[model samples]
Structure formats: C-alpha cells, structure tokens
Target chain A: MKRYNVGIVGATGLVGRKILEILVERDFPIQNLFLFASSRSHGKVITCGPYSVSVEGLNDDSFKDKHLDFVLFSAGKEASHHYAPLAAEAGAIVVDNSSCWRMDPDVPLVVAEVNPEDAFKHQGIIANPNCSTIQSVLPLKGILDKYGLDRVSYTTYQAVSGAGIKGIEDLKEQKQAHFPHHIHKNILPHIDAFDEDGYTFEEKKMIEETRKILHLPNLKVTATTVRVPIENTHAIAINASLSKPFELNELETVLEAYQGLQIIKPYPTSEMADGQDDVLIGRIRKDPTLPNSVHIWCVADNIRKGAATNTVQIAELFL
Target chain B: MKRYNVGIVGATGLVGRKILEILVERDFPIQNLFLFASSRSHGKVITCGPYSVSVEGLNDDSFKDKHLDFVLFSAGKEASHHYAPLAAEAGAIVVDNSSCWRMDPDVPLVVAEVNPEDAFKHQGIIANPNCSTIQSVLPLKGILDKYGLDRVSYTTYQAVSGAGIKGIEDLKEQKQAHFPHHIHKNILPHIDAFDEDGYTFEEKKMIEETRKILHLPNLKVTATTVRVPIENTHAIAINASLSKPFELNELETVLEAYQGLQIIKPYPTSEMADGQDDVLIGRIRKDPTLPNSVHIWCVADNIRKGAATNTVQIAELFL
Candidate 1:
C-alpha cells in the first residue's frame, strides 16, 4: 500500500477530531501528518496513530512547500473557501468536509461507497455532502440507481454535535444541572445558523447537496431539519414517492443487496443504528396514501458516514 | 364546584400515572376516587391528593352499583373496549384515552381548548385524540378556524414514554450500559407493536385520530412517527400547505393570538420545551418550495397535552 502524507485542517473542531480518530482506527496508511487549527489552539497536541502531533495555526504558508498527498478540511465554509484552494494549488488532493464547494459545478460531491469513481474526476477538490445528506443518500443511492427515485420528503432528528463542540457542551451543561430546562427532553427546530431566507443553514445544505449529488436539479425534495439531544447518530424518517411501484419484498431485496447497508427489518430501532458503520434501514413499506411511494427509517452515525468515514474513504480512493 | 367521583383505569401505565399526577396538581374537586389496574399491579399504592390509594384488580364489577361521575381510561385498547362500555352503562361518563372509541360516530373526540363545546354532545363517553395529533391540532385549531387550513404534513419526534413504562425503561437500561452497541444513539422506527397492515399502532393512531379530530376525512395528512430517547415531550415538524397564502409576520400574529401556545421565536431551542405546559412554537416560516405553504416547529410534554392534562381537563368540563 502506498503511504500518503495527510494533513487535517481545523483539527480542533468536533468533526476534525473525529477524522483523526477514524483515520487511526481504520489504519489509513499515513507517511506523515500535520494538524492545523486557529491561532488560539496553536501548540495543542492531537494524537493520531502513533504520533503526538502539535497543532499549528492555519496560514497561507502552512501548505506552501510541503509534499502533501491529501488534505482533509473540516473547518466551516469560510475556512474551507480560503484554505482548500491554497492546499490544492500546493499539490495536495483536497477532500473537503464542508458545504463550501458541494454545489460548485467543478467540484465532485463523492460518497465513497456510492460514487468512489467520482474521485478520479475531481478537478482539484472533492466535496463531502452534509452529514444528514450523506447518511440518507448512502442507502438510497444504490436503490435509486436500480429502481429510479421520483420525490423525497424527509425530516431529520439530528444530534447537537453536528453543530460542533459548542452544541454538545450546551446539551451537557443543560443535562448536568438539571437546568430547569433540558436539551435532551425537547427538540430544537433550528440546526445551524439562520439565513435571510428563514431556512437554517442545515436545511439548505440538505436541499442543495442532495440535488447536486443525485444530479437531479429538479428533483422534488422537501426537508425539515431538527436538532435533538442525541450525541452520535442522525436519524431520518423518509417518505419517498417513487416513479415506479414494486412489492415490499422486492424493495427489501434491492436494499439488502447493497453493500455497507444493514436492513433492520421488523422495525428500525435507534439501538440498531448505534455504533455501526453501515446505515441501518427498517420500517420499509408502501405508503398507503400515495401510489408507488415507500416509507423507510434510516439511521447512521453522523460523525462517521456524515464526516470522518466519508472523508477517509475519499482519501483512500486517491491512494 | 360540584365534586365528581373519579376512577382511574390502568393506574400503573405511563399516561395513567401522569393522569393521577395532574389531578392532584390541579386540585380537581373529587368526592371519592378509585384506582383500578390489571391483577399484576393490584394492591400497588398510588399517591393521589393527600392519600396513598391502593390499586384494585379490575373486573367487570369494578364500576358496578357505584355512582361514578367520570372514569379516565388509559389502559390499552382491548382493556378499554371491554370496560369502558361497562362503566358507561353503569352511569359513568368515560373519558377514554384509547383509539377504540376515537372514530366511533357516537363518541365525541374532544380537545378542551379546541372544542370544549363538543363535550356537551357526547352520548356517554368522549375520546381523546392521539398525543401527536393533540399537540399539533391545538395550535392549529384556532388558526384554521380563522384562516382556513387546507392541508398539513407533519413529522413527529416522539418520546419513548409514549409507549409506556417498558419503553422508557428500555431506553434507560440501554443508556446506562456501555455495550459494544449504542442503543440510545440511533432513531427507532417502531414505537408500538406492529399490526397486520405493517404500520405500528402509534402510526395508525396518528393517521386515524388526526382525521377524526380535524373533521376533515379527506384532508391531506401524512405522518412519520419516530421514537427518540427523550422521556417526556413529543415534538413535531409541521408544514401546512394551505389554500390561501399568508405572510410570515401575519402567521406569527395568528399563532401569538392563541391561548394555549407559547411562541419561542428567534430560535426554538430544545431546552425551551422541557417541563413546560404550553405548546412551544418556533422556527415559523413560509415554505419557499410550494405556494401557500407554511412551516412551524412545535413541542409539548407528551404526558401533559398528549395524555394526562387533556384527560383531566375533560374531567374538569363535567365537574
């Protein structure tokens, strides 16, 4: 196996930390590693496989003259916008985990298992879809290719960690004090920062990223993103009104045939979705209200399929 | 105030215990009180206003020869079907919190604030809509009455308590143990036992009860019920595609004018919903994807508005 010298940008954030954890766990061959964060986090230590690396402030000179194989970017869009091109120009394949370039015509939005071949076609940077979109699409991609998808209507039960460390800390503090209020016992409608259009950034990402990845600009997609107190996985209740009808048994067969997907028939319980790499799917049945429509419940670890695993998978394809 | 003698059936169940809790907290005037449950829970001490009442084994003769004013039944449907009619025949008004009588033409399905007057037309028993349906409709009832609601598409992030004590205990046990698997971290598609039609009992209740309560049999209502690890509140992401267009400011005005709702605009955090009695509405916006559609986020304690408080309020109407 060819060893790659990889660097992780925004190594202090939740997703960034998870990327480091997954790379070590998955035994990704790394020749050397670099950690970059903001100025305040400079000199902080991040332990990867067998190396204790110190974080350095992100700067234009950070990637200027290094022989870098791939750079995994998990910072917010602004940082990715400013740094990803710089890393690419310095001779590194950039696998960005931000929404920055997902909808850009030139960037390939790749889910490794779904579209690993899309990696070779990337001009300089590849975009990882939003965490919610990545998990939902992983199971649907193969099925849609085989059966053809028409319309997708979904609502998400997302964890606070998707917002980064602040979200998880907010929920933790609220839980510890039994703060007259509770984050776990309630649901927050807004997932990310609000925009002028009223849709939270998270909701917009689901819409735009799904359209871009599926190559269905005109696909009928409606989403409502909500943040719950869950810490790991993101769950979705989806009602997909398809263009063609098939028996529930046949649909099950199609979903079961897909690799890296778990068919949690009987009923998809949250317990079933926890700690598993595969997307757990269940509650599969035909919608009684609409012809050719099917309803399914999907759950995946947001930190994995939504971030680290997908990023590492993209990096693996480059190797 | 005229005091009414009340009997609580299924006294040990989740909603049953909540019903007892609210009755004491609200200071409902009671002439005499009786607790009834299955033989398994018979003789269990249940604390009600200033007294620890022993639960009696339920039998056909439990309500016989007694002048009971109201009987709140939170028992399963089979139990409710067998005993509610018996209590009603014994001259007691039954406020059944089961689906058995919800669609019965002779039974009035009531939400006190939404349609208290409907209570006067009840023959012998009244039906309480499903918890998810109750919370969604209470806020919409006044708006629909004033603005005319054409359709609603709602997805619920339901609490485990909706299933009962066992469901709550299952999640708690799963959370306490650090197994190789993560039980509390994922979303569970199944809430209740599956029926012949493949829909969980909870999903069926949302579909049937919402139609009957709204008095719009043909109203376009689609529901995906998911059980999260939360213990109390049931939260919903509601998108109502109306026949008439309404501006965001005007719709906020309509929601603010309602009596039982608390608008948590700016950002509707999950912490805002815990332990609160009022339905928390926020993330209000116009649906940009469709014409004449609006979306809003709603949350309320499932034990209260979903079951107990509604049951107690119905009993209060007769008092």
Candidate 2:
C-alpha cells in the first residue's frame, strides 16, 4: 500500500479526535501523521493505529517546511481562516470543516457520497458542509437526482456536539454560552447568529449549502435550525416539494438505492444514529396537500458522517 | 361568589397535579373539592393552597353518587372512558383530558381562548384537545377567523411531560420505555403507537383534534410529532397555507389581538413557556415559496395551557 504524510488540525476538539479515531479504525495508509491543536492542547498525546504522536501547537511555523499530502481542518472558522491557507499554500491539500470558505467560489463544498468527484476538482481547499446540512442533503441528493427539488423546508433537531466540545460540556453541566438558553432540558431555535432576515446563520448555511451541493442554484429553500440536547447525532424533519410528480414507492426505492442512506421504517429516531455511519432516512410519506411533495425524517452522527467521516472521505478521493 | 363541588380524577399524575395547583392559584370558587386516583395512588395526600385532601380510590362507584357540579379527568384513556361518562351521568359536567371523547360529535373539544362558546353547547361532557393541538390552534384561531385555512402541517418538539409522569421520570432518570429509544439525550419521532397508515396515534390525534377544535371539518392537515428530552412545555413549528393571500402586517395584528396568544418575535423557545399560561407565538414570517402561506413558531406549557389550564377554563365556563 502507498503511504502519505497526513496532518490533522484542531486535533484536540471533538470532531478532531473523531477524525484520528476513524483513521485508525478504517486503516488509512499513513507514512507520517501530524496532529496540531491550539497552544492550550499542545502537551496532549493522541494515538492512531501503530502511531503515537504528541500534539504540536499550531502557529505560523507549524506547516512551514513539512511536505504533507493532506491536512484536515476541524477548528472553528477563524482558526481555519488563519491557518488553513498556510497548509494549503505549503503544497498540502486542505480539507476544511468550517463555513469560512464553503461559499467561496473556488472552494468545493463536498459531502463524499453526494459529491465525491467535486473533491478532486478542489483548488487547494475543499469545505465540508454544516453538520445538519450534511445529514439532510446526503439523502436529498438521491431525490434531487430523480426530480429537481422545487422548494425545501427543514426543521432541524441538531445535537449539542455539532457546536463542538464546549457544546457537549454545556449540556453536561447545564450551562449556556454559544447557545442562547439552557440546553439540558430545552431546545434553542437560534443556532449561529441571527441574520437580518430573521434566519439564523445556521439556517442560512443549510439553505445555501444544500442548493450548492445539489447544483441547484435557484432552488427555493428555507430552514429553521434548532439545538436539541442530544450529544452525538442530529435529526431533521424535512418537507421537500419536487418539480416532478413522484409515487410513494418511487420515493422509497430511490432512498433505498442511495449510497450512505438508510431508510428505516416506523420512522427514524436520533438515538438510532448515535454511533452509526450511514444517515438514517425514514418516515417517508407524501404531503397530503402538495402535489409532487414528500416528507422525510433523517438522522446521522454529527461527528462521524457529518464531520469526521466526511472529512476522511474527502481525503480518500486523492488516493 | 358562586361555588361548585369539584372532583379531580388522576390527582397524582402530572397534568392532574397541575390542575389542582392552578385551581388554587387562580382561586376558582369551590364549594367542596375531592381528589381521586387509581388504587396505587389512592392513599396519597396532596396539598393545594390551604387545603389538604387525601386521594380517594377511583372505581366504578366513585362518581356514581357524588352529585358533583364538575369533574376533571386526566387519567389515561381507559380510566377516562370508564369514569367520565359515569361522572356526567351523575350530573357533574365532565371535562376530560384524554383522547376518548375528543372526537365525539356531541362533545366539544374546547380551547377557551379559541372556542369558549362551544363549551356551553356540550352535552354534559367537554374535551380538552391534545396538549400539542391546543397550543397550535390557540394562535391559529385568530388567523382562521380572519381567513379560512387552506392547508396545515405541524412539526412538534414535545417535552416528556406530554407522556405523563412516567415519561417525565424516564427523561429525568435516563430510562427508556413507552418511548422507543432512550430519552435522556435523544429525540423520538414516535410519540404514540403507530397506526397501519404509518402515522403515530399522537400524530392522528393532532390532525383530527385541530379540525374539530377549529370547526373546519374538511380542513387539510397533517402532523409529525416528536418527543424531545425537555421536562415540561412543548414547542411547535407550524406552516399553514391560507385560503387567500394575507398581508404579513394583518396576520400579526390578528395574532396580537388574540386573547391568549403572545406573539413574541425572533421565534419562541420552549424555556419561555415552562410555567406560562399563554401560548408564546413568534417566528411569524411569510413562506417565501407558497402564496398565502406563513410559518409561525409557538410554545406553551403543555401541562398548564395545554391541559390543566384549559380543563379548568372549561369548568369556569359554567361558573
């Protein structure tokens, strides 16, 4: 097997750690692997397969002379904005897991199953879609392939971890910071900051990312993003209005055939996706009043398929 | 002040307890008060204001000769089905909080804020609509009265208390049963058992109860109900297509004018309705794609505004 020097940025973060664990579990060929975190996490040691590497403090010199094949960035947007370019300019293919460059005309925003080929066309950087957006659009791509979507409305029950480690701790300790309310026994309709149009930044990202990934620049979509107390997975209740008429059986058949989409019966619950890699799609039915429309319930592990697994899948496109 | 003899069944359950608290808090005139519960909770004592009452064991004979002026039944369907009729036959006006009598033609499913007049036409029995339905319809009545409904759909983020005390305890202790999955950190799409048509019993109840409460017998409606881990209160994301195009300003004006609906802006959160008597409505915006359509987010104390508050209000209609 061929080998490559791979680097993981923001490695002490939740999604970052998952990336390390998954790379070992999936046996990705690696000759030399590097893990980078903020100065606060510098002394930590993380192990992957047979390799044990001490986390290094990420700064201007971290990627200066290291000839790396791929670097997966999971830090927040600011850190990625500051450091991702350095790794990319240093001749390393950077796969960023933030919203910073996702909408940049040149950065290819990819969900592996839906747009694997797009990852290969990336110019130095490839962006991963938002956690909720990734789970929703993964199954939606199959439907989109069959019939162009006319309008989509999403009500997302996103897990706490989608906000990263502090989000997980907040739920554990009954604290609130990035979220507007106590999330332990509550749900926050506000995710990200509110845009002037009353849509949260999180909602905006899902709407725009879905349109971009499906190659439907003109698709009408609106989303209400909410933060639920769940720790690992995110779920969405989606109503999609399709441009063409679709039979109930045809909707089921397309989802069943779609790679990385699991259509479970009696509906899909968030717990069912806690550690699962495939996005669970179920509760598939037709909207009573809308012609050519269907409703779907979807769930996936926010850290795995929504982030880590997808980041790794994008890296696999090169091999 | 006029007073009446009142008997409350299922006194130890969640909604039943809330009913007792509200009656005392609001100082509803009571000539005499009686508390009844199942055999297991029969001997328990509960306090209301300055009154202490022992729970009487409920049986076939409990309401046979009580001659009560009013009876509030919050027991499960079986108990309500067996005892509510007996109470009504004994000359007590029965206000049932179960699904048993909600769809009965002669029985009025009343939300005081929406249809207080309908309570008077009840043939000795009145029904409180499902907690989810009551909150949704309260604000919707303002719109329905102005412009007839074309089509409606609801996606609910219901708290565990909607499932009763055991459901609340399940989330509190991280236990699972009744709910398909663990409820501590997850969302269950299956609220009630499923019917052959794939809709949960809870979902069907919301659809039917809304039509009955709104007096829109032929209303086009559908619902997807999910259980979140919150301890109290339920939130809904509603999308309604109106019969005619509505000015956003006029829609807001009607909601503002509604008796028990609070039109809060930037969307309503579950925490906002934890102990509130009114249903908090917000996220009022025009649906970008559908003509004559709007999206509104609503939250209410499921135990209070949804059940106990409405049940007591029905009793007050006669007082």
Please, what are the lDDT tens digits per residue for candidate 2 over residues A1-319? 7988899998988999899888888888888899999999897888766878999999998997788999999988999999989999999999999899999989999998998888878889999999888989876888888887889989989888988888988998888875777888787787888787677789889989998898889888888778888887988999999879888887789889988998888766777788888999888878776768888999999999999999998898888
Report the lDDT of model 2 for residue A43.
Answer: 76
Instruction: Kindly list the per-residue Cα lDDT of model 1 for residues A1-319, writing each as its tens digit.
Output: 7898889999999889888988898888999899999989999998866979999999999997678889999998999999999999999999999888998889999887787777788878999989899888866676688778777776898877777777676676765332223565566666667888778778888887877777788877778887777776788877776667778888888888887788875765555555667888887877766558787888888888788889988898866
Instruction: Show model 2 residue runs off by greater than 4 Å.
Output: B247-250
Provide the lowest-lDDT 10-residue window in model 1 chain B.
B175-184
Docking class of 1: medium
Candidate 1 clash figure, as a count: 2
Q: Write the per-residue lDDT of candidate 2 for residues B24-113, one digit (tens) a residue.
A: 988999888899998888878999797799899998888766669999999989998889988998999999999999999999989998
Number of the top TM-score candidate: 2
Which of the numbered candidates is closest to the native, going by highest lDDT?
2
Best by DockQ: 2
DockQ of each: 0.53, 0.68
